[model samples]
Target: RLRAGVVMLIDLLSSVPSVVFGLWGILVVAPAITGVYTNISSALSGVPVLRTVFSGAPISGRSFFTAGLILAIMITPIITSITRETFATVPRAQKDAAYALGATNWEMIRGSVLPFSRSGIVAGVLLGFGRAIGETIAVALVIGSSPQITQRLFSSGDALSAVIANQFGESTGTYQAALIGMGVLLFVITLVISAFARAMIARAERRIGAESV
Candidate 1:
């Protein structure tokens, strides 16, 4: 239920200018994390605290996770809508049959709704992922524009979108060509991933149909 809400919100929010969310994420979530603790070194005392709890504590802003979370918020609605619509198409008879067999709600969902709607869910998720991958202005602002990957969720890192968005304006000649090439690469990668997801979903549907028969 919470996830669904996030999805719906994200879909609506994402349609908003990427700049808006980017600014909002940077201003809101980033500062929220920053205010929680001074730094990881201070938070992680010399003592051997439980790895999970210590790791879970907040730190700085502009981290990779923050960027991903912000991106998720932007894309959730698209995924949720697609997933909801997909699930809606599942035959009522299938759900009724499961319920008649004394299946719990979870069981009905898992066995009937999930299997039947797997393709749609996969497609939705893949589309969301693509949106995240290509997101530019919003991610640029929240992601701190750092080029390197970091272990900290709050530590900044650059994404392809950020790099492109940042550099494209100043680039010329070969540099421009290179930037465009990067975009081409991104396009190809997304297309390949989308294709793979579609194929996988198709295969899953076929397998489920065969098993049901």
Candidate 2:
């Protein structure tokens, strides 16, 4: 009952509108991280290679780091849910065999459960990555939509989805095609990632089946 309740709560939270997260990011999280972003940016400026990546005019609340943080929060429950489901599907006999072999609980999880679930976990992670990359409004709201490429996480930058979402209404002719092109690129990237993840899962399943036989 408690577990079910917890799952229900997570589902509710996960289903929240992206716009709400955007607003929350702007009003709450962005401001909260400003000090940390400033400190990190300042610290990294001293190192040569790190300076290139972290160097920018100034740290702003709205940046790639803020958008990424929000995306991570948004996708975490999805990955967690998928991983939990995968773990639940592990064979009872495998667990029993581990116990019979005098494996401790932690050892059984590490040796038996994790090995079995690794592919599923990877798939879940890839799915979460897809979700993060495709997110438009929430990321757009927080990411400070500058079109320039910069290595600094604290500097303003634009993602493909953000560009489409923010500019689609005003964009015309070649600009519209350009935005569509970006969408196509994003779609291709996601498709490739998903396909790779699926292939990994299938390979893992086949290996496990062969071992069992």
Candidate 3:
């Protein structure tokens, strides 16, 4: 019953509209995290390589960090569902054999379950990344919608999807074409990432098969 309830909750979260999450991120999350963002920005402003990344002084929470956090939250349910299903598919016989070999619970999971599920986990993570890349409204709200590039993580910057979504309506002529071009670029990038993910999954499977043999 508890497991069923948990599954139901994840399903509900995954099914909730992306726009709703965007509103929540902007209204609640952005305000709440502003102080933390400011502090981090201040602390890391003088570090070596990181100083560049955290160079900007952030007055508010809307930034790459905030957008990324929201994206992670949005994708968590999907990833969790996939991971749960993947773990459930691990063979009972394999687990029993590991236990029979005097493997502790942690050791059994590390050696048997993890190896068996590694490919599935990789696929799940990549799927989450794909979802995140395509996400628009939510990311745009939290990402500050600035087009300029900077080393600062706390600075407002535009993602390809966010820029297209925000400007595509008012844009005309070459500007409109450029936004459409960005859409094409986004599609090609996603396609490449998906192909890369498939390759990675295949490589993991081959390595796992070799280890099992």
Off by over 4 Å in 2: 1-6, 55-60, 198-213
- The clash count for each model shown is 5, 0, 0
Residues 166-197, model 2: lDDT tens digits: 89999999999999999999999988887887
Candidate 2, residue 185: how far the Cα is off, in Å? 1.4
Instruction: Give the per-residue lDDT of model 3 (tens digit) for 53-158.
Output: 8666455678888899999989989788867866876768899999999999999999999988887788878878988998999998889988798877878888
State residue 111's C-alpha deviation in candidate 2, in Å.
0.3
- How many residue pairs clash in model 3? 0
The number of the candidate with the highest lDDT is 2
Model 3 weakest lDDT span, ten residues long: 204-213
Please give the lDDT score for candidate 3. 0.84
lDDT of model 1, residue 117? 84
Winner on lDDT between 1 and 3 is 3
Please identify which of the two predictions, 1 or 2, would achieve the higher TM-score against the true structure: 2
At residue 112, candidate 1 shows an lDDT of: 95
The order by descending lDDT is 2, 3, 1
